[model samples]
Target: MTSSPVPDTPVEVIVDLLTKAQDIASYCDNMISDLFLAGQTLKMLIHMSQAKRVLEIGMFTGYGALSMAEALPEDGCLVACELEPYLKEFAQPIFDKSPHGKKINVKTGNAMETLKELATAGEQFDMVFIDADKNNYINYYKFIMDNNMLRLRGVICIDNSLFKARVYLNETTDSNGLALREFNQFVSNDPRVEQVIPLRDGLTLIRRVPPCKITDDEVFRGVTGRFILDRMRLDGKVAYVTGAGQGIGRAFAHALGEAGAKVAVVDLDGAKAETVVEELFLKGINAISITADISKSDDVQRMIDAIVSKWGVIHIGCNNAGINMNSASEDTSLEEWDKTFNVNLRGTFMCCQAAGRVMLKQGYGKIINTASMASLIVPHPQKQLSYNTSKAGVVKLTQTLGTEWADRGVRVNCISPGIVDTPLIHSESLRPLVQRWLSDIPAGRLAQVTDLQAAVVYLASDASDYMTGHNLVIEGGQSLW
Candidate 1:
């Protein structure tokens, strides 16, 4: 499929061995094309995906297996299946000679039986490469799907799908070519996956959609599709954001809405929340407003209940409500400290707890808490002991919750942002403090609300499923100082 010439550089140990295997194939009059380009492509994909476990349906002289194994991390592994015992015998010694050879598990016999055994053992793979018998391609796909051999969001790459370009001959009687055409059509018609044919011989890449049981209509009829970027789009997802009347919270609400989420904008000021909802509706985004005092458990529950009643589920929760107070530590009153803690720390906990209850039942959710640069470093020319401590508590809360809920499929992460050019920091009274922050910040400018948009989307989407207990810092190098 790939006509590009192989690089003229000296071959690696595995490549050299594969070259020798090619000579063997010629002597035996066996039909085998050097899969050097495909092997290289697989290596790049393995590295990009950080894939640890791979399943290969065919292994000829261990070229493809070795390529993927070499790209994998030290603890990574590849299960290579070859139907013929002779091929396995021929490839085993070559695999044993390479540094990554030990990573390859040469399994001889029928690949279908091997897949069934792996499935029965509850084994899952980050990627599955199918390049064995042509007649069984459709059966292999069905087996993989029915048995859940691939993990949710895992990839399946099928090689030689074009069958030497004979699949296009309408009147041809080639059995292998006809079988490939049927397999390609079957995969193309599958609604549960989004696929692409990247190479000439039809290197088809298929990605299983989210395991949350999203319907084909929901995936295909909406803005979401098989495109990698589209996977980040949160179509049909319901999102809730606190303090959405203005500033960073407002920006988060808008960003999530733009990404196809139905948003609930919660604010203490009922009028302000409704105003923001109206603005969202003007942009054709599905949104609602809920007035709640986030510090109060009753208010928080009511808000969550209202959102669930309207949308049936909560997929994203942004606990962004908090009050800031600036006073010298010695002069900071107990009332100020308690109030800050109640709103910033206690409010965040209440939101996470309420959301966690629903998400734990659903087995999936993303929680984004708004922390601050104060959580990591003391700000210059500003005395806000209570505020700094409250934000620090937020970071700890996020990490603790993230660890506890990770296995439950709910992720809790916090964003620590530097001084932003928002109303909170750009006031006349805070002009001197803002200038001091700029001097310490290497970026020489305060972050805009838009700067944090992509980070919020990343943590809120399925893209960050494996990431939890992490505090994403968007401080423009201020904390580095």
Candidate 2:
């Protein structure tokens, strides 16, 4: 078991308030953030992240607010969200007594309203601490991500994540426990990366998966002229994603379908592929699902034939399905190496070759492959010698085909992403290593699957007709260091 934490700064304010509030008939300690739990961690996290602005969803007793304020830089700001106005009065004298009190601003009333107001004003935060009503935990997290209120390198800490251990236990009628359980599961499936520290009530730290500034606002600025815009539209194109069942591949399937292409969602799992087809149908996009293993040449050929027969032509091919297995160089077995290579390199080759034949006959096609940052740079701290080497081979394969096919009206390209926050790293074994990886990244975040949507669209559309034999890397500059 971990030892209880001691604050780096003296919390004389907490001592004073507890001593005085004991006699107040309206006082309650249940909502207070104790130093033994989330209190001290918030201070250390702020200091480590060098956060300039912090948000506390519930500021009872001003202990959490004061502790975090003490950790902020001299110019830093801390916005406290509180529902009860009387607590501010009780905590005001204690706040006035501390030197860091000037940095704290307490906003009283409904927190949901405060959040909406902040959204309207275009506010963002480096750190957000939530210790509010349990029922609203999931709602708060969703709002923060949807509104872009969290900075690229920012983190959100949720207190009482374990909810007295009911979150992991059998079903409970306790509304608080049930809500926390739902919140934990929801975050697990989210695009962001998170880690839960078993600090008494459990503190979960979450951060965005990707870093990029090219949003709709930039597109809305009319950077693309109407004259050349037609080249970017995929109105009559036919596309297919090899791993269209879920995660990044699923996202690419949706993106290409939405871009006006008839998509064939291909995956090893027939049910998953069919589900994606249903999603496309809901969006009024003509689509189909093909179950095939890219490693098998027959399967790959059949998958391609089905698409060509349905659409009468294949204009775009997204070879996005791949796998990774980590093992020490000396310990990597031949079976492990072959499995990694079979999918990452050989499987991609078969898909490219089969799709190239159809495109070569038609005299036109765009092939987008999925590569990894590991292909270019060794992402250390986790040993995956085979996985890294296989991806490097994929880059070479893409360049080989791209140059050969360029003169034949077939453009081949690959997209290399930084360590994406996918289900691959959600295992308990990889959690600690993910934390180390985050610290080394300059952008301080992983790439969300959504971050790569537009990249695939560009490579598939005529906008990149002249660009071939290129590796479009969307990694958040993690390989630079």
True-structure RMSD, every candidate: 14.8, 17.8
Error of 2 at 264 (Å): 0.7
Separate clash counts for every candidate: 0, 1
Which stretches in model 1 have alpha-carbon errors above 4 Å? Answer: 1-225
Candidate maximizing TM-score: 1
Off by over 4 Å in 2: 1-229
Query: What shift in Å separates residue 242 of candidate 2 from its native position after superposition?
Result: 0.9
TM-score of 2: 0.54
User: Where's the lowest-lDDT run of ten residues in candidate 1?
Assistant: 1-10
Could you give candidate 1's per-residue lDDT for residues 316-347 as a string of tens digits?
Answer: 99999989988899999999999999999999
Local distance difference test, candidate 2: 0.86
TM per candidate: 0.55, 0.54
> Using lDDT as the measure, which candidate wins?
1
Shift of residue 355 alpha carbon in model 2, Å: 0.4
Flag clash pairs in model 1.
Answer: none
